[model samples]
Target: MSVAELKERHMAATETLNSLRERLKERRLQLLDTDVAGYARAQGKTAVALGPMDLVCCRILQGHTGKVYSLDWTPEKNRIVSASQDGRLIVWNALTSQKTHAIKLPCAWVMTCAFSPTGQSVACGGLDSICSIFNLSSPLDKDGNIPVSRTLTGHKGYVSACQYLPDDDSRLITASGDQTCVLWDISTGLRASVFGGEFQSGHTADVLSVSINGANSRVFVSGSCDGTARLWDMRVASRAVRTFHGHDGDVNSVRFFPDGNRFGSGSDDGTCRLFDIRTGHQLQVYPHPQDNSTPTVTSIAFSVSGRLLFAGYSNGDCFVWDTLLAEVVLNLGSLQNSHEGRVSCLGLSADGSALCTGSYDTSLKIWAFGGHRTVI
Candidate 1:
């Protein structure tokens, strides 16, 4: 080999290293920054557009065989868990972009999977009507393990979402198509309180989504097929703290601002509405560009600073909006790396530095957040 060529290569390598070192010096979370590895191509697709000015695809992790219905990155962003219609729960090592384990469940078409606040456990729910928790501390977890720590049995219908309460690591809340949301004491392994009646009136149809207030352990908001979103302050345990009406169609999702003064809802009517918690009055409504003709807004999340809103649409797109001015800062149209179907779910980490998206196309995509995004 020529010495000049070798010297040139050596110089190139050193330059790349120096550039990366400068970039890493400014990392926000001390996170393991790894680019995603899978480009899920379609049968006859020539090109994919993931938005130009904004929403660049940093990485794509593809492993699910069926529609990747739900996925979430653990608090530390080191591990990710995804559920698919193939009746499998797959956990991945987010850093190396490798599959860690495949958890086989009783049936196919699972809906959601969530990690505990401590990242020590995981819970999954689906069409099977039962929620199961897996302990990550077991030896099996790191070796492609499939251990069911406990099967939480109770719901009469599909369990949509199960999440650990923020203040308590041992407490969980599960919402179901059975028209109810149940709170369970994780340590005691018993139902703590049912929001359906004991604490608040149950929805007439399916309870589609549920979210807890970041500042209050006893407060939460639930959306239902009945076209209403209700705030349940279990601190009272007798009735809803407030009931709100605005959406003309079924409310598909609900999420609270970090401060707990307001909340947001996504509805089938193709609008994401923000409302005042104290007055039960609509504070703002971000509707579809097509004016009710666009796809449904499936999920909505707030930036840790509570100034930005990220909304996922059924038309296979995502939009980043400003909370204060109600303006879309970026309309990340159809992901260049899209699912064969719709993007069913997306989650931003607690600090708002990472975004995890899952879709019927059977894939998960993660995006890095900027500056933890506090109050705009």
Candidate 2:
């Protein structure tokens, strides 16, 4: 074809794409049921302001030579297990900042880790595409190394996240780059159920995070690169129970609210959103201020009362949001002695008395309401 004709065709195609994009945007706006922030404002609602004095960093746990990727608190809330790029999983006493066990991993690219419900074992997975478990009570070898108790294998891609079923250490759930979530039988080291795959109604991209419902063991939510979060039931692995969408970028993390009736998600789009499971509707959006560069949210958690939402960002900021009013209560990252690098992960204690944040700074800081003994 002549250059003139080719140019004309290219311009026509570009115009068509732009028109369709605008139409999609308009459709989304029309489907939104409510503007949550607007409703709150009309009702004269305001969040109780939280300051730096209300949340203080009480302990800094330093030992890892590499960035901390993931962490989980024991059911008792006194202990924590952290996985780092250093190829080691370190179990620490949260109150004392002492390492009780440091097991060298078989794979150095470990991306995620979790503590079993009984606190008797821990599991980790990474580029190896296998979930390896280590029994805390088992005796170490002559070299003082903890041996792998079991390995769950079958994933075709890297395991991105994992969590043990509440009150049941025998079963665990994991999200993977394979675009699926799997429930594993820990004892048999076999797949108990697979939630999504190429032939199933599941995530269309890599699943990055999973949060099992604290109120319902059989139910869980997974965040994916497809810009959606899906609710899945362990008993019905054929399809997701519901899919929630709103994010314009990858959904990086998902966490169940304290009540489990609702869940929150953090995304590469620089927004943290709350969704209701029953109605499959977005309830609120906590957007990062556009003037601040809008760093991607890497992880998120909720206070015990479900009133506060803590979101960690890629630029080393951890903003604590008041869930009801949809406002920033405090920025933990801006406090004294906060993480010096990107906040990679954060988790609230089982009792919600403290919050532990892991960062690319190779350290984890435990923040209590006021001091080490203060409870929020």
Candidate 3:
């Protein structure tokens, strides 16, 4: 090769190298600068104060006496309900964080629970392969007391996730270990439709999680052990709106942003992805550290402020990533002595006033959010 050609190639290589270095440094800054708890320390110990991980944990609801599997907050924000291995659903006051009610179930273990959009009832799905709904308010005495509602069954395996159609409390949907997602007429306790015909349905394997887009009430998404996430329209007949295929491992979670056009997924492959729902094109892929260490992404949440994304990893560490720049916001901390074991679930209030996490440690931890929100 001529000297001139060799020199040109070298310059191109140098430019590429410099660009990559700049991106790496940004990830590092995301790791350091975005640390939520670290910045809180700079301020006095108050509304925005707590020990790195330990102090941040508030009101461990200790009633299950077993691993808490699923939980949901009432739409009114007045109560939160949790399902556990003990086969019970316990209700708590949202503010005081005090237990208010508990109900024993006929099932073996409860896998999922959800609140009706109006906050008047709740549904619990379990290993017994049935979904149960309860009324938050019923024929009260002279004062005011809630009553047990009814049970809806049909799935043959464990129910993984249950979501109610947006703006409607009379209907609901659930994804299951039976490899199908079902829509139910909650008012009549009848199956409205069996999604995904009968051949192990749309998902390649057991469906793990499901989330509905509130902006477009008729659409929802689900992720599965088979390594893909599918979007379905409630108005259609088991037709997949989009199928996302890129993860090298099982997909555990999928959710839509409040805006409704885009969604995100987290997998056992140690990566979180954001995609455009219309064209089935992946817009961006956010990766875990190169160590990729243990490869289990426990939980993920979009900050209420829309400025950040939070994910809990298998190694007991949590990270915050900025959504706009696709940068890491901070390394929250490890679960070590904090939650007991891996963090399995996280919840953020509608107003984004507080955060809650459930883990194998058999407890729930709540974190206070204190970030400034600006319209972008």
Identify the candidate with maximal TM-score: 2
| Candidate 2 backbone clash number | 0
Model 3 C-alpha lDDT per residue in residues 5-112, reported as the tens digit of each score: 999999999999879856865654454443333344465422312235422445566767777777777666556788777777788887787887677676747888
TM-score of 1: 0.80
For model 3, what is the alpha-carbon lDDT of residue 311? Answer: 76
Q: Which runs in model 1 stand beyond 4 Å of their true positions? A: 1-54, 139-145, 197-200, 334-340, 369-376
Residue 49 Cα positional deviation in candidate 2, in Å, after optimal superposition: 1.7
Among all windows of 10 consecutive residues in model 3, the one with the lowest summed lDDT is 46-55
Q: What's the ranking of the predictions by TM-score, best on top?
A: 2, 1, 3
- Backbone clashes in model 3, listed as residue pairs: 30-328, 34-329
- Provide the overall lDDT of each model, using Cα atoms, as 2-decimal numbers: 0.76, 0.92, 0.72
lDDT of 2: 0.92
Best of the two (1, 2) by TM-score: 2
* The candidate that achieves the highest lDDT relative to the unseen native structure: 2
lDDT tens string, model 1, 39-107? Answer: 112233222222342455566788888888777768786888889988888888866768877787766
